[model samples]
Target: MLLKNERISEIVDGKRVIVKKPELLAPAGNLEKLKIAVHYGADAVFIGGQEYSLRANADNFTIEEIREGVEFANQYGAKVYVTANIYAHNENIPGLDDYLRALEDAGVHGIIVADPLIIETARRVAPKLEVHLSTQQSLANWKAVQFWKEEGLERVVLAREVSAEEIRQIKEKVDIEIEAFIHGAMCSAYSGRCVLSNHMTARDSNRGGCCQSCRWDYDLYQLSDDGREIPLFSENDAPFAMSAKDLNLIRAIPAMIELGVDSLKIEGRMKSIHYVATVVSVYRKVIDAYCADPDHFTIREEWVRELDKCANRETASSFFEGFPDYTNHMYGTHSRKTTHEFAGLVLDYDRETGIATIQQRNHFKPGDEVEFFGPEIENFTQVIEKIWDEDGNELDAARHPLQIVKVPVKRPLFPYNMMRKEN
Candidate 1:
């Protein structure tokens, strides 16, 4: 195995591009989002339990829900990793053993952790469970990597501060799997272990309940002529010091792959199901295409275009090169791009004719132009040329949610392809 795909930018047209088929690790903030991630092509997914997770704000799974989710993921041949990455008070450390026992019983493939004490606790309590070091550790050197490997950690989710070249160097020196944040939001703090939130609010990010005060708009004050801190004002009142844009690597997956990355991780613990589904699906198509045939990754421009629906700051190759000039972020932001509502996707279409059958999602009106994403095809335009309800009546458009509609597609459509329109 090549281990990872090359960055899509290095593609020379007509020249063969080799993809190493890196493991695509998507995020699952909730069960609904988990289903979509797995359905889209996630090799593995990471979700947080109800307690002791960095993303306490997310709709995390309950114990029973996690068990069901593990079974559901296994049915689709995807592995599930659970997060237990919280700094423990000395008083509560005694009870953590029970928590790991419960998690191991639930069939979680691995547990992501931060504190070294917790790693030691897990080895004693749940020795069979794999341990993935959370980025909170902020480990960048071979010493830390080797140390963790000695402690029996299987994977290290490296800090975003380290470049891909550093990871390549570390990989050469270490034996553990390196999972990097190929795409996602970034924290101004080192590996997201900042004291700013604790100083402002009582919540500590290391303790799992981060009141994301990082995203808060702040004013920079400096001692002025009078030796007093003064605030400057702009004509338009908006956050001027927020340096972080969302991290998006849609265009650079191939490059990250070339770095011998073991897994490409998408980071969004508080994301919505719609966001997870759209992103995971698009990346799934891109990775699968690259894996099945090297040429497929280059032929489709629509993959990145489809990403515009949930596109972040839109970056590529941030790992190998020095951190992009824009990498240092003050405020963690979200996707500004708005995708259409949960609309139907095309299941299949008759190649000989224009007839199409859609797996319904949301209702729509006549004359609505539905964007169709076909397998192997870059982009397609199809208007609601005609609508046939299941009743066989010619309707203007779907009026109810999940209402199946038969419409005419311009080109041949396939199973598992998607068709959606903005609501």
Candidate 2:
């Protein structure tokens, strides 16, 4: 079965035009995150499998789980793609053909790859599965895109360093689908090709062993005339850091749509479920609002605020306008904290008693004020007037993680609804 039609009508230049809305693609690190991504409004989700995936540390999917995830996503009219984007050595090539065939049998919509061997092997052995070139290839020009299109690849995830004008030029010249990162973390290196982790920690970043050595704190030193090293700064100065700010293109949706970008991808496969849900939901609203009525669309402050609650680092519109400057890079050891924390997820609700069953994620006590939100409901805040456990015993707090609790609520809530509290 095909996914839902994403094309919508918009009035452009006094003409009614039908535009293909960009797919809101989200990251699914595991099965739970996959469900959350679809529930919160992702048009599609990309996940890492157990082998040949870039995120070696993530709890990736098994072939069976990939099948189950495909079944779940199809019910919601969404698509699932598997990531086999790791740069391959000879040792990684033996069983890849079988794995590709297995993914094709598991009903995966496509496979994202960066290596020539895997691409050729997929085309030869697993021709049913669509192949998308990963951003690790760093295709920044129209000629590179044309080369890939000639090779029969369906899509090319443009390098993050590609500017808006470059994207426009590529669309003008190339006929392949274009995918770009719309939100999430940024690599300090070009298109995530970095050797800092391999040099510092003996982990090959291109082969799924990145240790994020660039984000670590490092002390700056100066060599003295006596051939001794001296600290560059006093005790009060923070250690130097080279982490790039996270990407936030909440305001760039309209322009990307006009450029005919096929997909807007969120970049964290190992992120938390709350982060996946919040980011996907925010972008979903933005894309829909802009596509529904381009002439009257405006960026909403609440959308930005909702995104701010889930961010762990400061965000920037990196490389979208042009080359980034000093403001795009984080130079000191500073961490960002959000104002809200995920507290619980709704499991079930009883309309007669006006009570909702919740699975506690963080801590929440009776009388605490919290906001509840869902895919189909407007956010509403209400005090936790009463709490009970699964056994119907009253409780003072839902302090334990994943604890099943019942709470009285003023409004009806559905499954997958999330609740958050002030930090």
Candidate 3:
């Protein structure tokens, strides 16, 4: 049950893009999202404990829940890495040690750590633990990577600013694992070492509570002739230059895998379960195909098709695939395309009736064509001609949330298929 497996043959290319399939390391803010990541095709999942990590505001797991989550991830054959990558105050050291002991007891696969003192402490305290340097440590060159390797860090999650070529150089220079971010929201500041969020609010983003004041359109405060403040974007036409675009590396997976990157991370601890399902599924198919046939691999249009199921701004390759157009939108929102309506949730399929039970998410009128996305094989759609409620009474449409309904089918569907349609 490998969510994403890519073994590569060495292709000599300093200029040509030759890559192996990078592991799809998805984020899991909670158990539901973790299930989605594993079901779709995440090789590994990184989650936050109560503290000592970014994304503290996410539906982060408590120690018990984290242990349960790690064991649950193993059932699907995915590795779980708890993020202990905080810039710690001296007082928090004892608390951090407790969390590490808990993770070790839980049998976690690894830990993503940032601070030098923390890494040193982790090596001395949890000798069996594998430490992955967080990008906040800023391993920009081969020397820094070598330094980490000598210090006993097994893997380095490279900074987002590192280019593909630099990644190749690092891979060539060292035996340590190099994991890079492939997709998700981009931080305007370097690899999220910013204090702006915490500066504005008493909540510290470094300790995991980000207010996200960066997203608001703040008016410039300047004195007019009358000493009154005025909006700049309204009159003089200078917009607030704060927000950045979310990273999207879907088109460049083939090349990235060839670079020998051990993991391809998706940055979204604060994202939806729908996003976890849709994006991971798309990458799963392409990575599967690439493994089977690297040279003959093709990016199907269906990948782009199913991608519209969630809301996203215009995508950029980030710094990994290539140089980005700096003015892109990397921040995430609840915006989804209106082209299709999410009709219903798929319940178990009836072997006897050849009908699937669905708890409706939206209305579906009769004779309307629909698309079906499962936990797997999501990009492919199976159309249903007729719709009905649980009573076996035919209905023109289903218009309620969580309304139990039935959809007749010729072929058998699975346990977690989603039913959708064009408006």
- Measured against the true structure, the TM-scores of the candidates, in listed sequence, are 0.80, 0.94, 0.84
Candidates 1 and 3 compared by lDDT, better number: 3
Q: Compose the digit string of candidate 1's lDDT tens values, residues 238-342.
A: 554444555666666665666667788888877765567677877777666665556455736666666666554534444446765544443334334465555
Q: Which candidate wins on lDDT?
A: 2
lDDT of each: 0.73, 0.90, 0.75
Residue 348 in model 2: lDDT: 93
Best by TM-score: 2
lDDT of 3 by residue, 93-182 (tens): 776666777788888888899887778777666766789999887778988998888887889988888998998788777778888887
Question: Whole-model lDDT for model 3 versus the true structure?
Answer: 0.75
Ranking by TM-score: 2, 3, 1
Tell me which of candidates 1 and 3 scores higher on TM-score. 3
Worst 10 residues of 1 by lDDT: 1-10
Which lDDT tens digits does candidate 2 get at residues 294-314?
877899999999999888888
Structural RMSD, model 1: 5.0
Instruction: Give the TM-score (vs. native) of candidate 2.
Output: 0.94
